[model samples]
Target chain A: MISDSIANAPVPAAAPNPKDFAKKKRTNRSAKLKQCKLDARREQWLSQVKNKGSKDESNGFRDSSMHERDGSDRSLENLEMRQRGEENDGSIHHDSDLESPSNSPTSNASSVLGGNHSGTNYTGSSSSSSSSVGCCSGCITEEEEDDGCLDDWEAVADALAADDKQQNPSSDSSPDHEPVARSDSLPELTNRVDSVVQVSKPECAVMVPRAQVNGQAWRPDDAFRPQSLPNLSKQYSFPMNSDRHYGRGAVSWAHKSVISAPSSCPICYEDLDITDSSFLPCLCGFRLCLFCHKRILEDDGRCPGCRKPYDLEPVEGEASLNGGSLTFRLARSCSMITRS
Target chain B: MVDFARVQKELQECNRDVEVSGIKVSPKADKLTHLIGTIPGPLGTPYEGGTFEIDIQLPDGYPFEPPRMQFSTKVWHPNISSQSGAICLDILKDQWSPALTLKTALLSVQALLSAPQPDDPQDAVVAQQYLREYQTFVSTARYWTEAFAKTSSLGVEEKVQKLVEMGFPEALVRSTLEVVGGDENLALEKLCTV
Candidate 1:
């Protein structure tokens, strides 16, 4: 699971190292090395944390004050060792602390390292972790734990733990806050986060990131590149498949409201990069690209979101994009959206 | 597929106001798709003083498709099945919208307890009794709630006997127990209020 998170971390940008700029491909190799080191440290940190938690649990009843003293002493030792490690690794200590996992030895280590690393590398990781911990941890965890269904819950518990740390500073601070650059892949990030987490302690999973967690799962990995969506102007609105609704006289004003078209269709999961024209037969917040809309109407005019019988009517309005009609024609050429 | 991002958000949003709403949602196990929602029965209803559990299953086409929900706790309501606990709410089926959430849906379920739709019955027998024999329905619902929903912390008999010996009739003590769902203190409060 830790390795998964390390893999997803943006390879520290090589732009700062002028020599690496000329050797772009080599920068990838160096980033891989850094990730490898981070992974190793993460495992070491996790093992230490497990040991600490077990020790605390077992020794809690005997004499809690004594146990707390011992725990703090050990924490101080760990901090000293981390500082030594940082000296050996340079600013990499700051990097590691920023992406530190919670209930972690690094949290102890970072408190000491913070005095030194706070000045230079504090902005990105510290601010992001402090601010986005409640919201982004689940998202980052879900995205990282794509294959492990059960780990999603752990991630959620971890998110709750993060919240607890935020609410009451006495609890363990989450060390693993990798500042993911959202602007580069906002939609893709949303798609990945949308995969969901397996929450072991559902009670703790609070504070939903509304903008990112709105349920729109973007699937057009190839089509959603920022460069492809150049002309937002030429998009045209298409009426629902004429065959879907027979009774509504094709001209009812009630059915004429235009859907604020989504960039992609739910039916085809295709982005408007290729097919710009979209139609929504109902105001149920679901849109099908013109191709899927036509097919649904031809077969059955039922709204998928709300199973009510639906009909599409073309409204005379300002055309949104130029490539709308062409995109519909393109989608018509392929039969990828036939019902099961 | 399942809108997991929405699920995560819904959980966070639902849990944030847990204190105010007294509604809780958590994964049944590790899986996000299967969840359990807990709602306290509304005040001034047959189900008052009880807690109800709901089972939630997120479909692959979630947000696009409504979540499948059923009463995990045995509920005596017209729109909820007494046997299988299937709910008869439209939002769970054909009347769903992508905009609606698991929290909202559970809120609706809680509301259904206060204002039951006997006309659209999931359990015909319960609905029929609810309409025809409203008094019997209330007593039976209260009794069932006391039997099933309660988790009495105090030894119930001592409290019941104590209340009975305090000059209240034994029948009144028992009925108060049914009304307060076995909370000794609440039953005493009901006795005092009456």
Candidate 2:
């Protein structure tokens, strides 16, 4: 699973040295050198993390503190080693993060690395629940063995563990937080943190430039040239065949109406990328991801987000992109709408 | 075809505030497609203190189309089918909006328990009882909830033993227990009535 995440990490991740860029196409030789170094470091990192988690667990205390320390340690190690691996993917991932709210990192990774598509839907955002996915998830490897937490109850426990790290900040004293099982607000907080971590963690993942990895992947290698990276308008949407990409991860989709306006779709909580058809704006200015739009088009005529009779052709035919149809469609919609 | 990514997010979001919301959704098995949603019976209703479980099957067009939810735990509400557990709620049908998450949908179901819309109901008999004999409706609903919704403290085997010891055939007692949804007291009442 760690390899899966590594593979999914943006291809040109970590800031690559300009020398690597100069020989971008001629990377067959240099790529081998980097791959060797990356595999060595990754193996070392994994062993150390596994060993440390077990050692700490045997001590019968300080599990939370140990895990916190381990998390920071992994991030630091990622920085030191991934500098070579982190090439073009870092900035590109970050840029895409900004432009596309409904990020399908798995799609990008799978598309980049064909046959390595170990697609976990809860990839980036809702991956907060992956504390239960102990097998492949790098962060919670020990969790699977310790309690055998196989249900939603695992989330509650991890949320509590994560909570302790926040509450005391005296990271050394995690013992007090262990037995604390019940909480009133944990479920709510878990998700808020989940979205924030989604934005931030991938940035860390993107940092470690895995040059040789990308040197092998990138089916559309020419399209990835730095110049073409930002111009996503041409791809309007992901190919329908790559439907799995549409299933990357979910965030807290049903946020209270009052909080900050949502950036992702209310339905899937997938990011609303205006450039991609991922952003299916309703006449009412409500947005849905294209997957949801296709489903709605086939099942019902109305937009799930709009709360109005859906004008099917409003997006492509009549309603101008600037949301001109909001008032225009509402004014002339139907007598039934006017009556009720 | 079900947008799994969204369902994953929904499950997390819904389960996150399980304590506060008193609503939970967990995958029935390895597949995220089939799920079990649990909602606490609304306070001040006859169904209070009983936990209701809803079985949710996501259609290929979920979010575009509402998920199919039925009572996994038997519920006695006019809008809910007493025999088959089919729910007659609009949002689950034509009124569904993608904006509504499973959490909200379950909340709406909870609200239905608190205030049954007898005029437009799935169970015509229950609706008629609700409109005609209001007190009888409350008591029957309460009895059904007690018998079917609550997770009984007594084990099924114990309930069977106790019922069998009451000078009733073991087979008859077992069937009565099943008929009354494993409630020992209700099984006794049913056996006595027969």
Candidate 3:
């Protein structure tokens, strides 16, 4: 919470010089993006290192697949974009996003529509390779959907069975005959399988802008614009925009959420005069009366509002400067040693 | 700054409607930082007719920070510590919002008396009893309420008189009674230690 205020306090400070502020903000954003990229790469490297000791063959396969995806990098970009959609929920908007599935599902569907819109057709080799990855993601989605209905898992099992059939085409050269027999036996199951196949197919070649138009019809105010970017930059930059919005707006949101000038002490439930010297130390903006503040500090310097430790930087600095060591550098070193 | 002005106002506001709310707040000492809160046990529960006293300590960040409150009156319940009288309610900790007052908090405490959340318990033994032997837990809670909370009842006076008869001076017995908030068994325990 304190970090949030530290991030946004400068926005209002630099408001007078709008041009400089904008430039500085952009640079700050880029720096954040670079940091995120480094963090992702570091995590990937750590995971790879961990896996290398256990399964060298699996690592080789993963590396080869990554290389193969790199050739038709557009498909790889699409996958990354979808992954970003998944990551968005895990980050800043986690609470609200999970609470409101209607919002995320529609947005996801729109983005998928946009992806298909941007890329007309995937090359045969790229399509085949991406289909496997897509199937895995489809299975994951199916698992998530299973929470809503038990039948979704059955549908996913059927999809997996079809996948197994595809892998062993030599054993059952008449794979088409089995699927047809199953489809005829259970039309409803065939319909579910059809939806699953559509999800896994990278060659959805057509984008229906009209689907997005229908979505917009329900909520005209929702700015549901279709994405047309077909390259890696489009997918890569998606997270950057989200990260920028999340970093800036979410900070301001937290900063604004707290009652900076509360009318009363929340603990005692008493009204205070506007001029009372309050202990508005933490970003939670909870104020303590002087007596309460002194009493609390006597026990521990945690913010009563949130039970966070008081950031005692100035106090620590003063202690180091005044007591024990007289020489300033020596005092600093002594304080550091004592602190450790 | 213990917003003495606000605390004074809250005390007045809380005590003013004691008849209606059955919740009262008063300063324990001259300082506003330390206070006492009284919440009548919720109606129609095992704690019915019992008055629960809660110790209130105002931290530095009074309104922003949640007020520190613990049960001074010991009774059997899952969410309240059987030994220390520490309550395990969300509002008394991180879930506390500034919008809540001492009166509201006391009301919440009273509500907790009626509805003990065994799933998130301060006393694991009590919670287990509540979940596994619910009828036994209720009777035990009711018995504790009768033994401790009913200060006006002759049963408590008899216990106090009996302790005094056992050669503990009347003043020490009375003082122990006050310390244990009229819990006969606990007062006897305190007097025995003395």
Candidate 4:
């Protein structure tokens, strides 16, 4: 029926403004360019890691005794080769790609290369190239130190921060809000060049802007203002109960004593209606009503209240039918009341 | 709730009468929301005179993912499995995007039926037969269409049995002849195998 309805529907006339359409096209193009640059950087970093293994193999004679010391040495070499090959070719082989080798030397390569490439691309100038080369040389000098590895992460983060600074020179005052600032900077950075190119096609020229506006002072709070526009809460409309009033009533006591009064269903966000409520036993004094309890039990049989394993006990009595009218009351516990 | 507004808009843009191998196809719907489609077999193939019927089902995640499609009218093709009507096509899997509509997917399916990809196949026997004996495969597929997929009074199991006498598997021959419930040829293929 829906398909038939769709089949018979009339085509709507095109009435969109040409200017607005052009603006949207431009914005999309810039976003796509930035994405392409990021993808290229990721590929280059992977290639560097692959090159690292080849370099290691060439130096194998110098470290001949080191290879025979551990049985895992051969497997490690194999893994490095596999990682390199998979990176060069986009297709994944087996499940090894999913493993996160966080402490591996390859991880360091990723952070260093990722940071440098993202930094250079973000700053829109070739001046950072000399500094990036210096950073790479510094990585080799400090390769033996654990602190050097930590510095690698910091360097990458700093490079990204520097790029963000170049993009949004007016808002760089606070270091605490750097992450939020970086997120906001992406859209603004893309918006500047959006009108210049057609982004859907991959062959467009990528023009990286040079950082001439670095002298402007930036504060982190300013970054938060633009970034807050796309917050998740603003996107989805949540129903708020305005009519219900919270009070210490008989129903409240029943909820607290029997049905766990303040309990909320995780899925539907409805209060557990007492008549239809089901009790789930747990180590903590918490219980979830029937609907939520059943769904979790079917999934993994883990307690939603504390995430602990529960011993299944048969529930008794008539199924609760509080309907959908009930509202959850949030109240301070007896201990908190006593402390006050 | 499902976004009926967007779904309706997509459905309207889809063109149902797709022509492949000179066969015109139009999907018919039963009162119960199930879909049945008929396509005249193309000339020069073993299925030349056959009117093939297929079933179509729109899963909850339609357009975002490929709709389950299967051939209800059985035919012999290297790419199409004998036991299951599963087709190996890129658009049905990784190449699928939400931008594609039901009509496009079906049109692609019709093209697949006309030109079987024997290299990568769901049924190894069919693929092998297609590779080893190209003429025989074509003749068998055409025979299947005339015997099983004919909408005329002459269309019957006896006619299909005549083709089986020429050395086609009975199960493959029969299931291929039956009309599908939804466009889920893949699921029906698996179902027939079981």
Tens digits of per-residue lDDT for model 3, B14-80: 8999999878898877789999898887889999998777889998777656799988777899999
lDDT of each: 0.50, 0.53, 0.52, 0.38
Question: Which runs of model 3 end up more than 4 angstroms from their true locations?
Answer: A1-340, B152-159, B165-167, B175-193
The lDDT leader among the candidates is 2
- Greater TM-score among 3 and 4 belongs to 3
* Over 4 Å off, model 2: A1-260, A274-280, A317-340, B152-194
Q: In candidate 2, what are the lDDT values of residues A1-340, reduced to their tens digit?
A: 2222332232123212322332342243235334444444454445446556454332222322222222222222222232222222222223322322123333233223321222111121112111111111221324333322111121222233345434323322333222221111343234223423432444343332223233433344443345645434435454432333333232333122212335676777778675433343454545666666665655655766656756645564334543675766667777568788
Name the candidate, 1 or 3, with the larger TM-score value: 3
Candidate 1, chain B, TM-score (2 decimals): 0.77
Regions of model 4 farther than 4 Å from truth:
A1-340, B1-33, B152-194
Which parts of model 1 have CA positions greater than 4 angstroms off? A1-310, A314-340, B152-194
Displacement of residue A110 (Cα, Å) in model 2 is 79
Give each model's clash number.
17, 20, 17, 33
lDDT of 2 by residue, B1-194 (tens): 78899899999888888999999999877898888888899999999988887889888877777889998777778999987789999999889988887889999999999989999989999999999999999999899888767745569987787677778899999988887556565577689989
For model 1, the local distance difference test gives 0.50
- Residue A162 lDDT (model 3): 31
TM-score of chain B of 4: 0.64
Weakest 10 consecutive residues, lDDT, candidate 4 chain A? A6-15
TM-score of each: 0.35, 0.42, 0.37, 0.28
Docking class of 4: incorrect
lDDT by residue (tens digit), candidate 4, A1-340: 1211111111001011212322333343234335444544564455445446333221211111111111111111122232232122111111112222122223323322432443322221111111111122222222232222221222232233334324222221232122222323333223212211112110111122212122222233433133434443433433221112222232443434443345543333356675434443554535555654554455455554454545544342112212222221123455567788
> Per-residue lDDT for B92 in model 3?
88
